[model samples]
Target chain A: MSNQDQNLAATVNTTQGSYRVIVGRDVIDDLGTELQKTGLKGRAFLVVDEVMFPNPSRRAQEALERGGYETHVLALEIGEANKNLETVQIVYDWLADLLADRSDIVVAMGGGVTGDLVGFAAATWLRGVAVVHVPTSLAAMVDSSIGGKTGVNIPKGKNLLGAFHQPKLVLQDVGHLKSLPAREMSAGWAEAVKHGFILDAQLLDTFERLAPQMKALAGEEPVAAIRRSVAIKGEIVSADEFETGDHRVLLNYGHTIGHAIEKVSGYGTYLHGEAVAIGMMAAAGIAERLGMIDEELVDRQRRVLENYDLPVRASGLDVDALIEATKSDKKSRGGTIRWVLLEGPGKATTRRDVPEEVVREAVLAILD
Target chain B: MSNQDQNLAATVNTTQGSYRVIVGRDVIDDLGTELQKTGLKGRAFLVVDEVMFPNPSRRAQEALERGGYETHVLALEIGEANKNLETVQIVYDWLADLLADRSDIVVAMGGGVTGDLVGFAAATWLRGVAVVHVPTSLAAMVDSSIGGKTGVNIPKGKNLLGAFHQPKLVLQDVGHLKSLPAREMSAGWAEAVKHGFILDAQLLDTFERLAPQMKALAGEEPVAAIRRSVAIKGEIVSADEFETGDHRVLLNYGHTIGHAIEKVSGYGTYLHGEAVAIGMMAAAGIAERLGMIDEELVDRQRRVLENYDLPVRASGLDVDALIEATKSDKKSRGGTIRWVLLEGPGKATTRRDVPEEVVREAVLAILD
Candidate 1:
C-alpha cells in the first residue's frame, strides 16, 4: 500500500496455490500486524527448533497471540536426521491431541528441516491446514520456504518423499540469520550465490560487493541482496511450480552434483549448501570441458564460493558412486540426468547429453 | 472420437491436475490402446490386492507390456488394515529399488484402499508421478479414483493422513465387479445410491427400477448405472475438488455419521458402504426430525437401501462415541460438524446448526 511496503514484500503464484513473502526486521515484532494483513485466520500452533525454544520461539508465540490468535508453541531437535516421517508422526500426534481442525494454522518456526517436517504435517493434516512459515535460516528464508515443496526423507534417499504444498504466508525476519552457526550460515549463502550464478549478474555483483556485510548480517545491503535472491527464486518457481518443465530446472545450477554429493557423503556429513558449493565447482568444470564456458567463469564462480567461506572441493567421495547418485537424482527424467550448467554468468541451461565420463571427470576433479 | 467412446469415458478437472475416467468392458483388454491415447507414458509399476493378482493384475501387466511399456507387477494384501504407511513404505521401497525416475508411472490396480495407499505413494514418490488407477471395486471407480483423495489411516483415525493427489487416469472394467463379494457389491452401491439421493432424482429412479440387475452386476444396466454415478461424482468434484466448499460436501451425504459408525464399530466390523448405508438412514431420520423432508421420501430412501441388501441399521454401538467421532471427522471444520442432510430426494445441503441431541436421536433410531 505504501512505497516502503512494496519494497519489503514479494508474492509467489503457483498453480497449486499462492502466498506472500515479506522480508523485514519488523516482520517478527510486527508479526501480528503482518498476519492481519493476510487472508489467513486460525489458532496458531508454532513448531520451532529446540535451540530457539525460550527466545525467538517464545517471542513468535507472543507475537502470534498479539495478533488475536490462540497460539501454541513446541520445540524439537531438528536437523537432517530429524527430517523424516518419524518426526512428522510426532507433530501429527501432537496436533491430533490438541483437537486441531482445518481452520487451525501450523506456524513452522525453524530452518529447512523444520519447515519440511512441520510443513509436511500441515500439508496432510485434515487434508491440509494453513502453514505460515517463519524461516529462521538464510537457506529457508531465500529458497525452501518460498516454494510449496514440503516433504520428509526416507532411508531410501534424501527428499525422495515430499509434496508441493504451498504455504499461506512466509514472514521472514533477517535478524534471526545472525544466530545461525557459521557453517550453517555459509551453507545458506551457497544457495543464494547459486541464484546469482544462474539468474542475475547484478545479484552476483551485489553479493561480491556485499560479501562482508552479508556474512556479518550487517547493513541494508545484506537484506537487499537476500531480497534479490528471493525475487529470482520466486520468479522461477512461479514460472514452473512443478519441475515438469525446463524453466525451474535452471534453479538447480549446482544441485545435480550437489544432491549426489549429499547422498554419497551421507546427509549431515556435509551441509546441503556445502554439497552444492562443491557441486557448483563440478558443474563449472563440466561446462568448461564442454566449452560452454571458459575457465575464467568457472574460476570466478569458485571464488564466489570461497568469498562466503563455503567449500569449493569435496574430499574423498567415490566418483563412480557420485555419478550413480546423479542418475538417481529426482531431476533425472527417464534415467538420464538433466545437468543444469552455466553458459555464462546470469545464463543457465539444461542438458541431458552430458556423458557419464565427463561427469566422472568433473566429480573426480572436485574431490581433494 | 466416436459417440460410443464419448458414452464410455468421463473427464475430471481439478486445481491439482486433470484426468479421464473411462468405463468399459474392454478397458482392461484395451488398456494398451487407452494408455497410448493419453499423454502419460513410461515404465509401469502395478500394485493390486492379492486377490486380483493372478487375474486382473497379470492381465494388466500384459496389457501395459502390449502398449510398449516396460511393465512390473507386485501384489500386496491391501485392505483397510493394510492401508497404512507401512504398506506405503513397501511401495516406496519397491519403486526406489527399481530406480524409478520422474517420468515413470505407478498404476494402482484394485479398490479404494489400494487406490489410497498406492495413490499416496504415487503422490509423494519423486514429489509425485503419473498414477493410472484401474479400480476393481465400485466405490473406488465412482469416488476415490476421481477426486485425487489419496491417503492412509493412522491409529488416530481413518483417512487422517493423506493428500488430494489425483490419478492421471482411471480405467474401469465392470467385469471385475462381478467377482466382488456380495457384501462388497452392496457396500459400493450405497455410495452410488447416495449420489442419487443427494443429487439426482432421475438417477435415484434408475437405481430403484434396476436395483436387482445393478446388485447382480448384470447386463447393460450395471455399467450404465455406474457411469451415471461416475458422472455425478465428476460434476461435484469438478465444481469443488478439495471439498473446501459446499458442492463437494454434498457428496458426503451419509459420510458424517457413516464415518463415525465405521470409527466407533472399529473399521473392519462394518464395510465402508454398509456403514454409510446405515448413516444414510440415520440422516433420513434427522431430516425427518428437522422437518427438512417428509416421511414418504425417507421411507422411499430406506426401500432403496433394502432393495440392494445394504444395511439400513446398526447394532451394539455406543451412541456417545459415535457422536464424539462425528466431531472428530475430517469434515467437521471449526469443530462443528456440517451435516449434509436432504431437503428432498434430489437435494442436499449442509447445516452446522444441527443440535447434539438431534444427532443422538438419529443415531439411536438407526441402532437395532
Candidate 2:
C-alpha cells in the first residue's frame, strides 16, 4: 500500500453536467475547504448515517463549521428498509425548519443509502439545490457516489423513485474504510472487481495480485483500486448521464442478474456487491458455455472472487423464480432482458439475443 | 376568433434539453403524427385525467391508436389533493403490470395536475422513460407543460417533490379549451397575462385588446396567446433551465406572493392563476411604493386583471399570515424573502431588499 500524501482526482464531464471525484488517505481533513469550492453560498446541512457519526460524520460537521459554514448535522438511522419517501420527509422537515434555500447545501455523508436519500431530498427541495457527497463506504465511494444518480426506493422496487441529479462534488476518503467490517469491505470489492471485468484489464490484474491480502484495506491498494474504479465509472457516466446509450449499460455487467438475486432473496439479505459477485459468476458461466470466452477466463473470474472471499453461487435458489425477477428489471426492454456479458477480461458486450434456455441453464448451474 | 386552419409551432432549444410546443385548432387531431416523430419505440401508455376522457383524452387515445400505436389509456380522477406519491404509485403499478421498458413511452394528456402527475411517474419509473404532454387547459399549455418540471405535492407544500425531466414534446390543442368552464379558462389567462407583465409588452397588449372576449375564447386569439406565452417560457427556460441564475427568476414575477396566497387561502380555494393574479397586484403595489413604476401603471394592471375577471385582491387575508407564508416560499433565501417586483408592465426584477414594513403595507392594502 502506498499511503502517499497527495490526492487523486477524477473529473467527470458530461453533457448533462460535470463534477469531480477526489480520493486520498485522510483527504477528509480538507472537507471544509473542498466544500467551499462548490460555490454553495449558504448554511450546510450534513445528513449523516447515525452509526458513522462518532468518527466520519462528526469530523465532517466540525470541518464544515471550521470553514465558516453554519452547519447542522441530521443523524439518520440507516438501512435498506429506511431508504424511502418517509425518510426523505424527515430531512425535508429539517431543511424547512431551517428555512434552507437554493443557495444552501446538503452534504450527504455515509454509505449508498445515505447518499441516495439525501441526494433525492436536495434534488426536490426548492425544485433543486446543490448537493455534495462524502462517501464513507467502499461501495458508495466507487459506484453510487460518483454517478449523480439520487433516488429512494418504493415498496415495488429499489430506486424506483429517483432523479438524475449530479452532485457538486464526491469526496472519497479511503481511510474511512478502516472502520468498515471485513465482510462489508469484501462485498464492496465486488463492484470494483466488476469494473475490472468490464472496463480495465490492468484493474483486473491489480485485483488478482492483491487478492490474498484483500481484506487489508488500510493502505494504498484500496485507494488505488477505488481511484481506478471511480475513473472508469466517471468516464462511462460522462458519456451517458441518462443511460440512453450502450456505454452505461456495459457498466451493468452483472446488474441484470445481480438485481434479480437481491430482489428474490429480499433486498437486505445480501449486500449489493455480494449479489453482483454471484451474478458475475453466473454471467461468466453463460459466456463460457456460449464460447464467448474460454474456460480459463471463467476459472480466473471464479478464482479472483473466491480469493476475496465473495460468494460465487447462490444455494437452493429456484432458477424459475430468478428468471421471473429479471423481467421486472428496468434494463429489460419490454420482454427481452439485455444481458451485459464478458467476452474476455475488460471486454464486455450488451446482448439482448441470449436464448431463454441458455439463461435458465446458467442460472440453474449457479444455484448450487 | 380566427378559427383559421393553420398550425403554429415553437421549438424550445434549452441547454438542459430541447423539445417542441405545438399549438393549433384540433391539434389533438394530429396526436398520432407527432408521437411518431418523437422517435419513441415500444408501446404507449396514455395517462389521462379521468374528467378529460369523455372528450380530449379519449380523442388523444383514438388518434394515437389510429397512428399505429399500441395504446393503453389509464384514466385518473384529478385534483390538487390527488397530486401526491400515492397517485404516482398507481401509475407506476400500471406501468409495472405492463412491464414498461425505457423504450416504452408515457403520454400525459390533460391539464397541469395530470401533466405533473404523469410526468413525475415517467421521470421516476424505471429511473426514467420518455414522456410527451398534451395539455388540455390554458394553464397546462402555457406554464406547467413546457417547463419539464414534473412533481407531486407532499403535505408540506405544492410541487415539493419533483424532477426536471424534459418532455419529448408538448402538444396544445386550442379547441380543447372550449370544453373548459368559463371560470377555468379565465383563470388560466392570469399566467399568460403575467408573461406580458414581466417579459413581453406585446403579449400584455394582446390580453388588453382581447379582454372583452377572453372568457369566450372562441378563436385565433386564444391560440395566439398560448403560443406567445409558451414561446416566452421556452426562451426563459432555455437560458436558465435549472433556475440557477437571474433570468429564470424573472419568470417568477408574481409567484412569490402568488404561492403565499395559494398557501394561505388553502390550495384549492383559488386556481393557481387566480392566486398569481392577486400576487401580481401585490407586487405592482410594492413596485409603486418603491417608485420603480408609477401609480398609473399599477391601475392599468388592476384594470386588465379585472377585465379578465381575475381577483386583484384577497378581501380578508391577514398580513402577518401572508408574510409568514412568504418566508417558507422556495424562492426565499433563509430568513429573507425574495420578491419579484415590477418596475412597470414588461419589466420585472427579483429583489431581496424589500423592507418587511413595506411588505406588510402592500399585503394590508391588497387584503380588501
Candidate 3:
C-alpha cells in the first residue's frame, strides 16, 4: 500500500501459481504481514538453517507470533551434501509428527539449499500446502525464491528430484545479506550479474559500475541490481512456468556449466554463484568461438566476474567429467547438451547443435 | 482412428495439463500409437509391478516395443509397506543409471501402488517427465490413474508424501481386470460405485441392475461402468485440478473414512475400494442420521454394495484411531475433519460443522 512496499516487492505470475517477492532492508518483520494477506490461517512451521545467522530466523518467528500465528520453528543443520531425499524425509517426518494439515504453512527461511529442501517438503506433504519462502542468500532472493522450482539433489546429480510448486509468498530481507560472508555475498552477485548478461545490459552496467560497492551491500546499487535481477527472472518464469519453452532456458545462461562445475568439483567446493561465475566464462568462450560475441565482450564478462571476487575458472578440471556432468543436466535432453550462449550482453539463445568438440574446447579453456 | 478408439477413450483436461485415458479390451496394445499422437518421441522406460498379475505388465512392454518404442522394463517387488520414499529412491537410482533424460518417457505399468510410486518418481525425476500410466487394477483405472495425484506413504501415514504429476496418457485394458482376483475387482467396484453415489443417480441405477453381474467383468456393462466412472472423475478433476475448490472434494465421498480404515487397519489390510465400500456405509449412516437421506434409500445403497460383494462394515475398529486418522486426511483443514456427506444419492456436500458426536456414531455403527 505504501511506496516502500511497492518498491520493495514484486509479484511473480506463472502458469503454475503466483506469489509476491519482497526485497528490502530489515523486511523480515513484513513476512507475517504479507502472509496474513493471503488469508492462510494456520500454524506456521518455520524451517531455518541453523548454520547461518539465527537473528533473522528468530525475528521471523517472533513476527509471525505477533501477527497471531501459532509459530513452530525447526532449525536444520543442512548444506548441499544433505540436500537430498534423506533430508526431505527428515522434514516430512517432522511435519507429520507436528500434525501439519493442509491449511498449515511451511515457512522456509534459509539459502537455496534450505529453500529447496523445505519447499520440496511443502510441495509433497499432504500433497502440498502453502509455502512462504524467506530466502536469506542473494542467489535465493534473485532466483530460487522467485520461481516455484523446488527440488532436492541426489547422489548422481544436482536438483535431479524436484517439482514445479510455486510459493505462496517470497519475503526477501536484504539485511540478511550483511550476515553472509563476503565471498558468499559476492557469489550471489554472480547470478545477478548473469541477469545482466542474459537480459538487461543497463542492469549489467549497474553491476559493472558498482562491482566494488556490490560486495559491501551498500548504496542503492546492490538493491537496484537485486531488484532488476528478480524482475528479469520473474518475467522469464512468468512466460514459461515450466521449462517447456525457450523463454525459461535463457535464464540459464551460465547454469549449464555452472551446475556441472558444482557436480564435478563437489557441491560444497564452490557456492552456486561461484560455479556460475566460472560457467559464465565458459559460456562466453563458447559464444566467442562461435562468432556470436566479440572477444572484447567475453573478456568484459570475465573481468566483471573477477571484479566481484568470484571465480571465472576452476583449476585441475577434467574435461570428461565436466562433459559427463553436463550430460546429466536437465537441459541435456534427447542425449544432446543444449548450451545457452550469449550473443552479447542482454542477448542469449539456446542451441542444441553445439558440436561436442567445441563444447570440449570451451570447457577445457575454463580450467586452469 | 477406429470406432472403438473413439468410443473407448475419454479426454481429461486439467489446469495443470491435459491427457487422455483410453479404456477398453486390449487397449494396452495401443500404448505406442497413442504416445506417438502426443508428439512425445523417446525411449519408454517401463516400470512394472512384479507382484500380482505380471502377464499384463509384460504384454504392455511387448506392445510398446511393437509400436516402435525402444522399451526398458524394471519390474519392482513392491507392496504397500514398500511404497515410501525408500522405494522412490530406488527407482530414482535406476533411472539415473539408465541415463534417463527429460525427454524420455517413464511408463508406469500396474495398479494404484505401482502407478503412484512410478508417477512420483516421474514427477521428481528431472523435475518431472512424461509418464504414461498402464493401470491393470480396477481402482487405478477408474480413480487414481485419472488424477495427477502421485505419492508415497510415510511411517506415520499413507500418501503423506507425494506430488500432483499428471500422466501423459492412461492406457487401461479391461482384459487385465480379468487377471485380478474377484476381491480386487470388487474393491475397484467400490470406487466406481462411489462415483454413482456422489455424482450420477442414473449410473447408480445401472450399477444396481448390474450388481449381480458386475464381479464377472463380463458383457458391456462393466466396460460402460468403468467408462462412466472415468468420465465423472475426469470432469471433476478438469474443473478443480488442484483440490483448492469444492468440486474436487466431492470426489472424496467415501475416501475420508476409507483412508482412515486403511490407515487404522494398516494400509495392506484391505484393498482401497473395500475400505471405501465400508466408508460409503459410514457416510451413508451419517447422511441418514442428519436426515439428508431416508432409511429406505440408505438400505437400498447398502443392498447394492452387498450384491457386489463389497463390505458394508468392518469387523473391528478403534473409534479414536479412526477419528484421529480422519483428521490427518488432506481434506481436514484447520484441525477440523471435513466430511463429504451425501445430501442424497448422486448429491454430496463437504461439511466441516458436522457434530463430532454424529461422526463417532457413524463410525460406531459401521464397526462390529
Candidate 4:
C-alpha cells in the first residue's frame, strides 16, 4: 500500500484501542469466535432490542455460551421514544444483580437503539468495560454501530447523556436484515447513499448499480456495498478524535435538517435515515442555490434515494419551525447551524455563513 | 531523580491531561483568574453544594463573572442517598436550559458527594465538558476531588453508576473548612492521615508536628500538608490509565471494609473518613496476624489517627455480616477481596489470599 493509503486506512483506534469492523452475510454466528480473537475470557452480558429477543439474540447468546462465555440475556423495550436514561437504568440493574465486573464484556444485539443504549451501559459500567455490537438493521450496519459514539437521550435532548466509548468490535451481519421491515430497509439505504455522496463517488455508483438488490437484501453485493459504507464511516470517525468534530462533521451531511424533521414530526413519524434522506435533499438544494454544485448532482442524490424508495420530499410541516429546530441541533454552534454540503460527488465541505433566505428557499424546495 | 525517587514522584498526568492541583487558604477566591489561565472563554455553570451557596459559591461566582464569564449558579442537595441518576437529571435539566455547549465548563463547588455527582454530570453532558472542582470539604479536596473517579450510588451498590472523568483543575481551598463542624473536620483528617499511612511517612510526621494547628484550622502547615496529599493522589491517579486500576488500588488502603461499613451502617451513620479510620485499624490487625506488618507499626497508625480525633475502632457491628459485605466491595475480584495492608508507614501492598478466619478476627478485634 502507498503511504497515503496507509494513513487513510481507518482502524477503530484511539486511547480506547484499535478494533476490527467485520462485515459479512452471517458474521453474527461468529460472535463467540470473534470475541475469542480479542482474547476475552469473561462472562457475556447480552442486552438485546425488544424486537430482536428470543431469535437472533438467542443465537448470539448461544454462540457466546458455546464459545465458553457464561452468558446472560436481557431484552429492553426500546425505540427513539424509549431511548433515554431510564433505559440505561434497566441495564445497570441487571449488571449489578450479576455482580458484573471489569472482566465482563457487554454484547448489544439489534439495531442502532440497542447498540447506542447498551454501548453506553458498557461505557460507564465499572467506569467502562469492553463492548461488541451485533448490528441487525441496515442503518446500524452502515452507521451507528461502527463509531465509538454511544449515548442515551434525555428529556432535554438526544444523546445528551453518554460517553465516547468504542466497541471492541462491530459485527455487521446482513443475514439479520431479512427480518426487518421494508421501510426500515429503505431508510438505511439513505445513509449508504449519503456516504457515497460525501466521500466516495465509486460507492455512489455501486449503490446505483445494485439498488434493487440492496433494497431487497438479496445477492452478495449487499454485503459488499454495506462493507464499503462501513469503511467510509470508519475513515471519517477515526479521522476525528472526540472534539472539534470537524473532520467527522462531513458525516453530518444531511443530519442538520434531518434531525429537525425528526423533531418537528415528533421523532415517531420518520425513521432516522428517512429524515436524513429528506435532509440530504434540502442540503443538496442549499448547495445548488450557492452554486457550490451543478443541478446534476442534486438530481443524482435524489435518483439514488428514489431507487431505494427513500423520500426526497417532506410536506405539510412548518418550514419555519424546521429552520428553528436546526438551530437547536447538536451540530449547531453559537446560534449558527454548520451545514455540510457537497461541491460535487465525493467532495463535502461545511459552511456556517449560509444566508437564512438561501436556506429557507432550499428547505422550501424539498417540502410539498 | 534517583531510580526510587522517579518511581514515586507522582504526577497528575494521564490521557485526561496533567492538571494543576492548587492547595491554598483562599484559592476559591482565585477561581475566575485560574479559569482564565486555562484559556477558557465560555460560560461557567457553577453547581455548588447546597450548604456552600450564598457565601463562598457567590464569591467564586463573582470571581468568574469578573473574569468575563457569564456564569449560572445551581445549588444541589447532594448526599449518598440522593446521589443517583435522578440527581444527575437535575443537572442535565439545568445545562439544557442554559444550552450549555462543550465550550462551557461545569464548576463543582462542594464536598465529595457534590464533586462526584457533578463530575459524573460533566462527564456525560455533551459527551463531556471540561470541569474544575472547587472542593469545599477537606475529605473532597484530599481524596475524591483530585481523582477522576466520579459516580452515583444505585440501589445495588455505591458508585455502581458513573465514569472516570478527571477535572481540568482541583482548587483545594482550606478557608471553607472554618464553617464545617468539628466532627466533620475530624472525618476529613481521616483521609489525610490514611494517605500518610499508605504512601508518605513524612506526611504522618508532619501531622504529628502540627496536630493542634490542623485540628484548630490555625496555620500555614495545614495548607502545605493538604498540598502533599493532593500531590500523592494526583500521582496515583495519573499513573494508571482507564483499565489497569492497579496503581490507583494502592490509594484504597482502608476503603475495602470502609465501604462495607458505610453500606452496613445504611450509608448514613459514619462519615467516609470515620469508617476508613476504623477499617485502617482492622487492616493493621490483619497485617499483624499475617506477619506482613508489626504491632508497633499498627500502634503508630492508631496514635496518628487519634491525634486528629479519628476513630480507630468501630464498635457493635455484626462481624460476619461485615465479612460478607467486604466480598461485595467494588475492589473484590472473582470472590477474592484484594486487601491493601501496610508493611510500614510508607509502604502498602495488596494481597488477595488473606484467609477468611484471619480477616474475621482482625475485624472482630475492633468491635465491641
Name every residue pair that clashes in candidate 1.
B148-B166
Worst 10 residues of 4 chain A by lDDT: A1-10
lDDT per residue for candidate 4 within A1-368, as digits (tens), equals: 11222212235766677877888766667778778888888899999887887887887888787788999999888887888877888999999999899889999988898888898888888888899988898888888887788888987788887788888878766789989999999988888899999989898898998887777767777777887888888877777857476778898889999999999988779999999999999999999999999999999889989999989999889999999999888877678888999999988999999999999999999999
Question: Which portions of model 4 show Cα errors greater than 4 Å?
Answer: A1-10, A243-245, B1-11, B243-245
| Minimal lDDT window, size 10, model 1 chain A | A1-10
Residue B174, model 4: Cα distance from true site in angstroms: 1.2
lDDT of 2 at B250: 84
lDDT by residue for model 4 (B280-304), tens? 9999999999998899999988898
Error of 4 at A214 (Å): 2.0
Error of 3 at B26 (Å): 0.9
Clashes of 3: 1
Q: Model 3: per-residue lDDT, tens digit, A178-289?
A: 7788888778888888889988999988889878788877787787778878888888888888878899888888888899898888767988889999999999989888
The DockQ assigned to candidate 2 is: 0.51
Fnat per predicted structure, each in turn: 0.67, 0.45, 0.75, 0.75
Q: Please give the TM-score that candidate 2 achieves against the real structure.
A: 0.94
Tens digits of lDDT, candidate 3, B1-368: 22445545578887666888888877777888888877788899998888533566777777788778898888888778799888888889988888888779999988899999999999888777899998888989999998899978888877888888888888888888877888888888888888998899999999998876677877878888898899899889888988788898888888899999998997678888899989989988898889888988889889988888889999778999998888877777666877888888788888778887898999999999
- Segments in model 1 whose C-alpha atoms lie over 4 Å from true places: A1-7, B1-7
Q: Write the per-residue lDDT of candidate 2 for residues A1-368, one digit (tens) a residue.
A: 22323555578886556777889877777777777776666888899998887667887888788778999889999778889888988998888777777788899999988998898899878667889999988889889998778878776667777877789888888888888887788888888898999989999999999876556874677667889899999999988887878898888887878999998898777888999998998899889888899989999999998888899999767788899998878887667888999989889998888898888888887897
Candidate 4 - chain A - TM: 0.95
Supply candidate 1's per-residue lDDT for B351. Answer: 89
